[model samples]
Target: MTETFITIFLVFMILAAVVALEARELLSTVIAVGAVGFMLSVIFLFLRAPDIAIVQIVVEILTLVILVRATISRDTHFFEDEREFFPFAINIVMIMVFLIFAFWAVKTLPRFGLNFSKVAPYYLTKGLAQTGAANIVTSVILDYRAYDTLGEATVLFTAVLGAVALLRRKAKAAENKNG
Candidate 1:
């Protein structure tokens, strides 16, 4: 039963990802991406990773809203004839190669039960005591590897600033032309 559930989840996730890639309409593609994230979150919850599931759900919701808003505010049409069958074929081949490599990597990964049994339990028991964080996810992310989180935030801020700068430049050029 569990295996069947997993298989179905995987199918949904893959189908959503593929549809997102192939969708010509920006809104449809964004919806498909959201579906992929939702399915992955379900899978994570099923695998007993509630923290990851919550994060995935939140990020998916936030990104989908942002993308939808951006799409609605833009003048660009989503579908372009420039994206042809050749690119689709190439994408399919690339996806297949990635899937193959991913499966290979997963098969070679260390068995969590055998290798990290003590680590997980110990953390679960002593994590709050050590970090004073109620949420294990927060404790792990903010306390254990804070530098990585800081770097990720920095990168996100940089991307946002770059996007804002580009948009402002475009707006200024449009204003100058109209004036």
Candidate 2:
């Protein structure tokens, strides 16, 4: 069952990525990215990592909201210049790089459930005793990995602030011109 779920979700993720790349409208691209993020969260959940899944969902929501708001006052459609060779070449190179990585991963990743690392069990057993937190998730994030969590929060806050500033500046510029 897990294998089937992983296989199906892998296909979904790949398709979402392709759609996001090909989407001609910025809004559609954003939606495609959200779809990819949702699929990733589901995959993480299926792998029994609720903490990662929750983080993915929350980050995805923030990213989508910020992207939509920042883009709201501007044209939403993507304009592709047919004469642009550099971008096309870059895209081709990226696809080649992705294909190479996929090939390498297929040959290298351990079989599912085979390498059951001792890390998870250790965390689950000693998390409460070490951190004095009853909730394993809370202890894992806010105590054991507090610095990483703080860094991620700081980055996310900075991104949201930047997006808000851009939109506010654009609005002010328009208002000044009109007034």
Candidate 3:
């Protein structure tokens, strides 16, 4: 039963990713991406990683909401005349290559054992002593690898600020012309 569930989840995830890539409408693509994330969360849940599943769902919701808002205010359809097939083809190829690499990496992961071969069990046991944090995830993110998290946060903030600045400039230009 568990195997069947996992197989179905994997199939759904693949289908969602393909649909997201092929979808021309921005809203439809965003919806497909959200579906992929939700399917991943289901897979995580099936694997007994409830914390990861919850985080996936929350991030998916945030992404979909942001995409929907952006789509509402901007043109959702691409100009067919200006579309270049080469870039699209290259993007598709790159996505497939990355997907293959990801699958290979997953297959190479070590199985869980009681001897603390992996980091999760070690963190769950000794993380409190090392980091003085009750939650292993919090300790791992904010203490053990805080620099990576800080870099990610900085990148996200920069991207958001750049986007807002560009949009505001366009809006102001239109307003000034009308005035």
Candidate 4:
């Protein structure tokens, strides 16, 4: 049941991404992107990563708010898309290849509700002993997988920086125009 939901949501996210890519209106593209992120957060929840899911949803909401605000404030909402046949054909082919690979990857996924990782057992058994943390999840996340946690934090930080930079640049441009 969970697997089916996750699969459906994944497909929806992919479709949303394509919609975002093809959308001519900036607001429409932002909404499609938000849909994709919302779906991703739900998928993370389905995978039992509630912490990650919360973070994902929070970030997604912030991004959507910022982008929607920016889009609405802009004078020109629609952009003309250049329809080059050769590039469009290449993109279509690439999307087809990606879908094929995604299907193959999904087929290879282990069944839900099963402990499939060899390292999980070790973590479960020795997590507390090694990390001196009472909670196994805490021990695993903070001690055993510290590097992975750091990498995730780095990615989130980078995204925030990029968003901030974009907004700042736009503000500077507006100031210059006004001056």
In model 1, where do residues sit more than 4 Å from their true spots? 1-3, 73-104, 111-122, 169-179
List TM-scores for all candidates, in order: 0.71, 0.69, 0.65, 0.71
Estimate, for each residue in 1-179, the C-alpha lDDT of model 1 and write its tens digit: 65678789999889989899788888888889989989989988887789889899999999999998998788645676676798879988998999999998999877643554567777788999999999887887898878899999999999999899887757887888999
lDDT of 4 at 62: 98
Q: Which segments of model 2 are wrong by more than 4 Å?
A: 83-106, 153-179
Best-to-worst ranking by lDDT: 4, 2, 1, 3
Where model 4 places Cα greater than 4 Å from the true spot, the runs are 96-114, 132-135, 151-179
Q: Candidate 4 lDDT, tens digit per residue, 1-179?
A: 89899889989999999899898888889999999999999999888888778889999999899998898988757768688899989999998999999998988888667778899999888887888887787788788888998998999899999989887757887888999
Q: How many pairs collide in each candidate, listed in order? A: 0, 0, 0, 0
Error of 1 at 6 (Å): 2.6
Task: State the C-alpha lDDT per candidate.
Answer: 0.86, 0.88, 0.86, 0.89
Query: Candidate 2 lDDT (Cα, whole model)?
Result: 0.88
Candidate 1, poorest ten consecutive residues by summed lDDT = 111-120
Candidate 3 C-alpha lDDT tens digits along 14-62 = 9989898787788888899999999899988887778899999999999
Pairing residues by index, what is the TM-score of model 1? Answer: 0.71
